[model samples]
Target: DVAKGYILYLEDISVSFDGFKAINELNLYIKEGELRCIIGPNGAGKTTMMDIITGKTRPDQGSAWFGQNINLLELSEPEIAQAGIGRKFQKPTVFEQLSVFANLELSMAGEKGVWTTLTATLTGEQRDRIDNVLVKIGLIEHRYQDAGSLSHGQKQWLEIGMLLMQNPKLLLVDEPVAGMTHQEMDRTGELLTSLAGEHSIVLVEHDMDFVRSLAKQVTVLHQGSVLAEGSMAQVQADPRVVEVYLGE
Candidate 1:
């Protein structure tokens, strides 16, 4: 049966690397259409948790589900992606040589070979989809430019546009605003907040000010488990969170 109003579920998830627990019996739940921010100190198992969800890493013990029916543990990385999970790493990875338009075209949901997909004529609906994503990512004006020619922040937005092309149900974004200018950071925050209700976003970031700008529910991880979860104000006031993370 489906877990009503939830998009993801992780229970008793644990993994070890060379006898060091990277994830220790972690449990998390993501509500449908929710925008959740995850923050943590280094080695706090944040990446590991995302890897587990995307099938990039396997755990020694746990159950993960997409919605209520899809068993994430039984799927491969590509399978998980095809099942509607999209991940964007800290670094922007647009096709530098390709036009912004072409990059999004290449990322469209399909099973066709890349060459065939690129060469095939796009239906009117497909073209409209690309246009819509360009507007959403704030790159409509740069659609014809080579991805490499865009500034760092624009490149990040383009990469996000690429993911939007696939229409994923859940998105795992890691440090999206790293190395961005303050203006870019604000724009990025606006973009992410706008997308929240339509797509469940799990954002893992280290920028306190950026995180505060989002003002969404926050989860703090430590020693392979969640140490704190609340509003930014509540967590910032947490003495344990301060002692282990903010205090440093």
Candidate 2:
């Protein structure tokens, strides 16, 4: 039976690469509008799990669903993205030469040819949307600036703002605060937490302090499967997690 409140479901999923099981019978779920943090040591199958969800990799056994009726396994990568799933890798990939406002403009949902995108004019509503996202990402003042000149953290936020322009239902973020200063990390945490009620977020990070700052549920992955799921404190207290990850 399909679950009622979940925005994502990964059940009994497994994938192997060259005979090594990367994700083995992993089960994970995200409730609508919830922010979930995933953490694990290296080789813990975290990336593969994200791959499965985003349609970049298919599992050998089990199912992945986006919503009540959307079968994720049957969709192409672009199709999945069109269906409202967005992913941001650890590295920021904004258009360096373009202005921040222009970057968000090009990222808005729709099929646009290069010629059309270059010449198109924005409607009042569209401009408002971009402004809204700019505010959300704390980049309104930097809107007219070249993306290349922004700091590391600002680039990451701009990229996230670009994703928001597409109005995704779920976002998968990979190590967003890896190189951020403590202040930037705090800002990022605030931005992400603010987005949770409108869009479900699955954040994969190794920064335990940043994860704890979010104060959300945390999932610990080990050996290609979920080892622990609870609050940050709860998982830290979990002997299994400490032995495998935290203690190291």
- Candidates in order, TM-scores: namely 0.97, 0.98
Top candidate by lDDT: 2
lDDT tens digits by residue: candidate 2, 79-98: 99999999999999999999
Best by TM-score: 2
**Could you give candidate 1's per-residue lDDT for residues 122-151 as a string of tens digits?**
999999999999999999999999999999
Q: Assess the local accuracy of residue 81 in candidate 1 as a C-alpha lDDT between 0 and 100.
A: 95
lDDT of each: 0.94, 0.95
Model 1 per-residue lDDT at 148: 95
RMSD of model 2 against the true structure: 1.0
